[model samples]
Target: MLNIVLFGPPGAGKGTQSQKLIARYNLVHLSTGDLLRAQIAQGTELGLRAKKLMDEGLLVPDEVVIGMINSALNDNKQAAGFIFDGFPRTVPQAESLDALLAQHDTKVSCMVALEVAEEELVTRLLERGKTSGRPDDQNEEKIRKRVTVYNTETAQVAGYYAQQQKFHALNGIGAIDSIFAQICGIIDQHQPATSESSRQATDEVKA
Candidate 1:
């Protein structure tokens, strides 16, 4: 399983790059934002709670998000792997995720973080806000707060993966395809021939 965590700040083009990655890697896309939105659309209790916290510029409880991830993992037993987006926003969440994956005898193959300048992100988000229709994106104050929250709180997740030597940082200030090529290069290096052959051997053994 080639599980990948696509890490980036708001408006860092994660959504854009994710499309290409999914096509190339055949990875299931597990996006917390999408999961929350579905829960909200269904008027579920969890969704209502998430909305309140989100409206207040606060994070949803870790347990809620983790449960969603757990469910997704269980449902995709035959998945080649998953591309996790907009998740594990805290060190504790990352820790919980590590434990969760371990239970399934798999682990994060790599964490690919897109490094973008704060100002560039701010500008990009504000421009996106013009048509995004999300109230939070429309407000510069909220956007800055969100960015600050990520920097102060969520940024620690990177160090967690870095310690394991699974963190890959890509410069996110270039043309879209160029940036994706860089990402592909990193993933290719991470999962070299030996890893693929090993996975094939493991599959044969399981069979």
Candidate 2:
């Protein structure tokens, strides 16, 4: 399995690029944020617990987040691999994720971090806020705080992957297609099965 961790700060185009990578790699889309929201909407026990912690402004414990990811993996047992987006936000989480995937006899192939400037992230989030109506994105203070938290806390996750020789920091500025091509280049280097399909997908996108 060619599992990948699509790492980046918020507003770094992870969501957008994930769609293309998924198509190119034939990977399952595992976004912990989306999974939690779905669980919360369903009012599941896990969801209630997560909601309570979220309401209290406390970070949801790693176990809860891991459980959600576990369920997702269970649900997609036959997936070629997974594009992990928005989970493993800390070193502990990264360790936990590794343990979980190890149980399945696989591991993260690479961590493609979209390295974008803080100013660019802020600008992107603020612009997205205008129409996204996401309160977190609307406020510059909140945006900056989020970025700060990511840089201080979440960014360290890269080190964990780096130690494994699976970390990459791809430039995230410039035209979306150009950046995506760079990302695809990294993925291709690591995931051999994706090479041919990736080229096909890129051609399709360009066409």
Candidate 3:
């Protein structure tokens, strides 16, 4: 399975790029934020706990998020691969994800990080807030705080992946298509080659 960890600070275009990557690669989009929202929507036990924390302006526990991810993995057994967005925010979380993927005999093929300037991120987020109506995005102070938190906490996860030689960073500036093409180039480099027989077998199955 071609698992990818799409890493970046908030407003770095992860959501937009993840959608494009999913469409192009046939990968399941496993976004922890989306998963938590779904859980809350369903009023699941985990979701209720997460909701309470979120309501209190606190982050959900890593275990709860991992449980949701585990469920998603189980639910998509037939998926060609998975694109993980807004997840594994800390080193511990990244370690947990590695262990979890190991259970399925798969591993993170790469971590693609979008490197954007903080000023650009703030601008993008403020513009997004105009329509998104997300209070956090509307406030410059909060936006900067979020960026600081990512730099101090989540950015360390990049080093973890780098140690494993699976981290790729790209400039997240310019047209969306151009950035996506660069990302695709990175993913293509890491993508495993399928033998002709395996390709034929997959085609036959599709047929």
- Scored by TM-score, the top model is 1
Which model, 2 or 3, shows the larger lDDT? 3
Please give, for residues 118-172, the per-residue lDDT of candidate 3 as tens digits. 9999999999989975567688887888888789989999999999999999988
What C-alpha lDDT, on a 0 to 100 scale, does residue 133 get in candidate 2?
Answer: 57
Structural similarity to truth (TM-score) of each candidate: 0.90, 0.88, 0.87
lDDT of 1 by residue, 88-164 (tens): 89999999999999998899989999989889998998899899777777778888888888899988999999999
Q: Give candidate 2 regions above 4 Å deviation.
A: 43-58, 193-207
RMSD of 2: 2.5
lDDT, candidate 2, at 94 = 95
User: Tens digits of per-residue lDDT for model 2 on 62-178?
Assistant: 888898789888998999999999778999999999999999888888999988999999999999989975567788877887788788999999999999999999887778877
Q: Give the lowest summed-lDDT range of ten residues in model 1.
A: 198-207
Alpha carbon lDDT of residue 190, candidate 2?
84
Clashes of each: 0, 0, 0
Whichever of 1 and 2 has more lDDT, that candidate is 1
Candidate 1 backbone overlaps, count? 0
**Which should have the higher TM-score, number 1 or number 3?**
1
